[model samples]
Target: MGLSNWPDICLGSLTPLLPEDFPIDEDHEFKPDNFYFLKGCVHFKNTAQILDMTNKVKKSRWRDFSQSFLRDVDNAAKKADEEQEKPKYEIKSCGEMMRTIKTMVDGQKGEKICELSMTFVSFDSSMVRFPDKEHSRHPLEICPVEAGSENKHECFVRHSIPYFWDMSSQFGTLYKCLNQKRVKIASICAFGFGKDAVLAIEGDQLDDVCALSTCIILLNGRDAMDH
Candidate 1:
């Protein structure tokens, strides 16, 4: 939530974070034809105002912001001492996550690549009652899949979140989680009027009902997914 350039609240706190729109899922999958993937590096920095130090650093604004986090033993001790009194200028600008993400997105370097699958499905029939299943026999649901049934839904990129909140001094693709082994996951699909029904197989139940305010956006195909 640091609000310097983007968030604009407190400026960069040097706290590594997921991309603003991370863990996001879209109703449609990214067209495999498009095939867009982002891979990059996570440069750590010791300072926050990367823009200000660009000239002194002799590197891109992003690099200064990320690589400024220092690893020198002496630098670490000094930073710990400054924790007693929080200063507006003195922030431990550790910039690994963002830097790595940027690099990955920029097609440079990464331990993992971020990719999304998008697709569009249209109803079999042009006009019909939404989700009523009044016409269950027909494929014309509210939204139509371009192809046929199966694989009609959209899915988005999903990955387990690393717990960097702790300053345990862990390093490199290292974060403890209940399920830390799973690298990437794809989830979230389907969109429609409040009353749309997805066919469940063999006694499985599928129903999603959100509050009026929340469903309002969903009904209109407005994505308000949280990262």
Candidate 2:
């Protein structure tokens, strides 16, 4: 569909993912809910420094012997180390069929957040798994929904079995099955094509895992179509 129509679809289909017990501000009527916008292509860099003892020893002889010179080098090295140590998300390809998404837990330690694997029988369908969950082995299926013949923008999000089967008639409503309960989590609307595209996610259900998963799925789908 056109980019202009997505906001209405998103807002209309939006449902609270949070539990009823979650605290809410009764007096703040004007405050807008927080949301995240993701680009089609994301780039991440690690600035960790590698200290060379040989270079340090050689430079020590010719470089300034003052304490100020030593302090400057120490600070630069420390800054670089800190930047590298910070936890961030990463995506890695596992052969041809599987792509894994992970995040840095403690310095240099990696934890699997989720995995997206293409189905052998149906190229259009893919499965996602959360390794940390109790039922990590069970994979959730995700597929693209057709949005009119003229509209090129594709919308893909996780849905319950009933919702998936009844999508044609119930396209306006979306639900996510979590822990055997149907919950309305997040809605992701992607605009444009390929690397230039952008993704807008509903504020209420937005989280690191949800945002990253949606971005990976959409980008991968685009790449598959290109081939």
Candidate closest to the true structure, highest TM-score: 2
Which candidate achieves the best lDDT against the true structure?
A: 2
Report the alpha-carbon TM-score of model 1 versus the true structure. Answer: 0.13
* Candidate 2 segments exceeding 4 Å error: 1-87, 95-108, 118-123, 134-138, 147-203, 222-227
Output the lDDT of residue 81, model 2: 55
Measured with C-alpha atoms, the lDDT of residue 87 in candidate 2 is 25
Instruction: List the candidates' TM-scores in order.
Output: 0.13, 0.39
Off by over 4 Å in 1: 1-13, 19-186, 193-227
Task: Please give, for residues 1-227, the per-residue lDDT of candidate 1 as tens digits.
Answer: 11223321211124423322233333322211100000000111222110111112222222211333212212333443465422112112222321110111111221222111111112221111123332122221122222243332211111222211111121111111122222211111121222211110111111111111111112222121111
Total backbone collisions, model 2: 0
Q: What digit string (tens of lDDT, one per residue) describes model 2 on residues 1-227? A: 11222121121133412222122223323211222223223321111111222222223322212344344334544554566533244454443433323222222345556665543222245556676643222344554444233322223333222112112221112333333333443333332242322222234443445444544554444334324
Worst 10 residues of 2 by lDDT: 44-53
lDDT of each: 0.19, 0.34
> RMSD for each model, in Å, please?
24.0, 15.9
